[model samples]
Target chain A: MKLEGKRLIWQEYQKEIADDHYFYARSCIRQTFFPGAEAVFVKIMKDELGKDIHDEQHHTSCTGIGYHADVVPFDTTMTVIARQFALMTEAGYENYAASCVTSFGLYTEVLETWHHFPEKEAQVREFLYKATGREFNKPKNLAHASDIVYKFRHQIAAKAKYKLIDKNTGEPLKVVEHIGCHYSKMFPHKGIGGAEYPYVLSGMIEAWGGEVIDYPERRHCCGFGFRQYIVQANRGFSLSCSKKKFDSMEPYQPDMIITNCPGCPMFLDRWQYALSEMEGKTYGKNNNGIPVFTYEEVAGMIMGYDPWKIGLQLHQVSAEPLLDKIGIPYDPLSKFKGKNGEDLGIPETPNYLKFYAD
Target chain B: MQKHIVVIGAGPAGLESSANLSNLGFRVTLVEKEEVTGGHLNKWHALFPSLASGKHTIEAIVKGLNPGIKIQTATKVTGIEAVNDYFTVSGHNGWQEKADAVVLTTGFQLFDSHRKEEYGYGIYENVITSADLEKQFASGKEFVNRQGKKPERVGFVHCVGSRDEKVNNLHCSKVCCITAVKQAIEVKQMIPEADVFCFYMDLRMFGRHYEELYKQAQEKYNIQFIRGRLSESTEDKDGNIIVKVEDTLLGKPLRIKVGLLVLMAGMEFPPATKALTNMLGLKNVSDGFIQPLDEVLHSNLTEIPGVFIAGTCSGPKSVSDTMADARSAALAVAEYLK
Candidate 1:
């Protein structure tokens, strides 16, 4: 009953499983925007967690985002899920997960619907079987990388031999965690815990010996609204969403922010910059802009894993100063090297490095 | 000392700005033209992507307020003025107040779809706007055509009263594309046998799970999408509406007959904006959106020192964006007063 010292739920799963032979479901955005998140998941799953995840190219994207847009039909969602399952199963892999919350939800929903409605399931299975000549069974669970990091949080903290000490306050950090809409809001009951308090990313932040700040707009959507920023190009909407979280946490003055979804990070980071441009007054004197990270990158930081492997450098909003403030000795210029050993101006120290001392 | 801050409009933006300012230790008064709060959200059952209960979002915002925030429903802002650093706001029934700062979170009205006669919105029995559909769902009425039969086919026309040079609305109503997608999905949920189609210039799933929702509607619900604006709608003998559109993607003219047609309407600044702007000496964009002091910075900030703007009052925005904008506006007020 007591959650104080106990490891979070997902932390237990990572320790129990040695092999990470995961079927990584692809995201359409990942193919375009943040491939680094997938890279981080793969690197951690292989080198640290000691798992072999299959990155088989034959498995097409889940096609759930398009379906949610009403551009794709329900039959296509079923077909996509079926085909994804067949590819995973045919490759002799069972455990499957997606970096996208929408994909995870879609795969889970279609599988559940198929199992509950035998007739619908039969039709889909027959169609898939006829097409691929393979029997497809849904994975035991379709997960986000954040869900996994949260599951194995204790191990991550235990393996973390390095800690970040704050230079100014000489104290650990009080953090704010922003989870995306897909992780909880889209299907409130589908994930591990209730949407209001999805302990996945927050659990990881806490396990790392940092405080999690609860802001007023904690549960609101990031307002990426798909192409609203592009089609109509309303910077106000995107900036406003970021402003809500920033304002809520301003009183707390969190050292940095942690996000679970890619979309959340994109909006939170880009909008912060946009807000700064639009307002002329920076959030927190331009220094108050919270550095955000995906759950895997957070775990990697806690575990003292390779920063490059975690893809921390690819972040739009630089995390360098937070790393220095946290007392993590990162070579600002030496780190985040290009293929030819050129620095990408990425900070060596993670924002939370100083908050928790090993 | 309680500093009076008057907020005009009881919509999500106005309500949120009032509630947040009130919480930050200011005496706030919110005026609404409607008898109820929640602005547009009250009319809908759920929001996009997340499909969060609209009632809950409105309630959550309301719950954050303290007694200091006075919400006056069925009230209108008649005039506003700035004398030096302070502002005087006036309304009906001798309602008058002075505020150290004023926030114009006055929300937007839906553009009248009937103006686009080609769509046959008011003339056709089967054609309706997104707001009309939302009103029907809120009233617990099932979606049925004039004949009272469960409609087998539904067509959604996007960009009605928005993004048309002819109407002088060059700005895209950012919410229409996603709202169309959300409503299409909702229709599929209500009537699984119904074939829903969206006529749009482009499917903008630019948000998180927006693309996913679009995909879900397509892959899960089998909705059809045509990249075109409906040219016109005509009734057949059976009363089914026939829509004529040039499929932009297909580069050909096409005619589609459907039982019901839903138009995705745009946003317009309420008529009160001009009166308020004139009285308060607050500046607005040419299109009547309350122009922020700086588009890049002070987006929620007004030039009149204490006046702030949030939500679609500044520009057209989705519900999620409006709430976030409201929070920022709240922060702007908090910092200014403090």
Candidate 2:
């Protein structure tokens, strides 16, 4: 209710992000689920903004999923992260930008652990040097890819071909920004606006001419707890967690949900369909489900990138509703087309949830 | 010559100390930074255990002060200097006093509720602190939520900033538990039909009559005491606060929607007191409260001979304990001046 008071808290949680020359670390889940998101991010950074972002093929996963699932040991995860740092050092980049919120959190945790215990850093250095025969200097700056987008939000807004404002109603889109718990829950100072009210995605939403909706469950986890979803029986816990968020945000009737985490957008989007199928309950208007998009996808869409090219069609909840509201143009035929214009085949429609093809 | 004693702060501690010092044939000066005396007591509606009016209590304490005792309001102590056997205390208003002894009754300040962001203190319209609730009670206005409607259900969260390692404050605030119980009873008295709930980790009713009041709160008022620390709070569209707390007794997570949620913010040493103690080269404990020479035997005596600490400046204490501490400090100063 008091926007001024929340602004005071947001001002206290600002973090420094490097301007250029970032060594990009790709996420496993993001690349697997929303491949076009990272592609659009790289395209926007290189072609549109002319920023230097080096994405090395040799860089491996940070093993955040396995580590969080309790399958991988802590020491192994540390050395795996050390290997990523080694690759960044070989590429001669000091600023490390992660494509995943989980990776960003893991990197922050490892760095903080190293800062607190130099012996652990020494042991990890030995592990990396012995295994990969590589030396690494710690990154000068650590930032999530969304932090980079937030830092240049004004510039993106200036170059945006279309705003997030509805073309017909002229009202700003009501956007729900669900931040990942790991993004700042462990270390609040590492994130853009602290853990409670992160401003990374909201900052971009504001600059892009969208009204950020402060729902009751704005800070709830997306229910993508690795172990919870990894195990079969515990998957209900995850689904119910996302359901709780949906139930809480239902009153707000947000236009769409935007997220920085790789799992959040996927879970928030997929769970809408799951909930609709399970209980015949739909949160959005007209039996439609709430659309969820990664921050990169939203940025690319506002920048006039084709919706198919940005992979909005891949979402379980149709982005057509949001695209129509924003008046972004997209050919209906290209909804299921492959990169080379081959027919990728349309998926089957659900009973309750609205699908574009249906 | 009668030695002049300067009592910094004009709260109950300072008032009692000045009264006792003046009664012992010493010239006393009571300095308060605020335009009015009574400190936090002025904002409070009633005291705990007995539910006495805070205004009347302060009036009785003020009446006990001899007319010879100089009362200086709105005088902030800028610096204190020890020259030979006498001390010179200078105020921010350019007033000065020479004293044989200085009693530091500079009390504790309430913990800032904003630091616990998960509770949504500042962000949520329905989430307020205990002090804010006290001010509402003292205002004699009808208790209402942000929507200006009488709250159906009110919740009190205990030990907001005390004994919480996340905020780096581990010491118990000692007074918040009783204060929450007192305020909960007051809320019931004001709104008899409204449901009142108290969520606490563990109720520390260590003081005399405090346990009886806590028992009375449950037996008489029907206040629901859930043994759980509040995890977080969110505000609904209707300005009601949805609080998530585990009912430890049931070993299950519980969610309750309350029309108003009150956080029992704890006490910590005020920054002014810290600066004054540091300037005077007095020792402070790890928790940042002024250090007593011996907490058991010589609690009023500081390492510095002429500097004595009273009330919550040394630690968190109830108003009754602060008054007793002030009298003990006055006795210690009298013994030191001998």
Per-prediction interface RMSD in Å:
26.9, 1.1
| C-alpha root-mean-square deviation, each candidate | 26.0, 1.2
lDDT to native, each model? 0.73, 0.92
Q: Against the hidden reference, what TM-scores do the models get?
A: 0.48, 0.98
Clashing pairs in 2: none
Task: Please tell me how candidate 2 rates in CAPRI terms.
Answer: medium
**TM-score of candidate 2 against the unseen true structure:** 0.98
Largest DockQ belongs to which candidate? 2
lDDT of 1 by residue, B1-338 (tens): 77788888878888888878887888888888778888788877778879887888889888877877787778777867777778787877568888887777778889987567556665567888998888777777876877797889999998888888756677778888888898899889889999999998876677778888888889999999998887667665466787878988779988788999999999887775687787767776767678889988889898778888889988998887888898899898888987
**Please, what are the lDDT tens digits per residue for candidate 2 over residues A1-358?**
7787789889999999999999998888787788789998899899888999998889888999999888989899999999999999999999999999999999999999999999999999999899989999999999999999999999989999999999999999999998987888899999988988888998999999999998777777798888778898999999999999999999898999999998999899899999999999999999988899999999999999999988888899998988989999999988899969999998998888998873
lDDT string, candidate 1, A1-358, tens digits: 1233123332322322223567776666753444456776677777777767887787776776677767888877797788888888888887887778777767767876877897988888888778777778767656776676666677767777544346577676777787766765555555554354556776677678777665445665675755545446675666676686676567667777777765777777667666665664344434446677766666666666556545565665566666667655554454457667865553343332221111
Candidate 2: where is the Cα deviation over 4 Å?
Answer: none
lDDT (Cα, tens digit) per residue for candidate 2, span B94-139: 9999999999999989999999988988888889999999889888
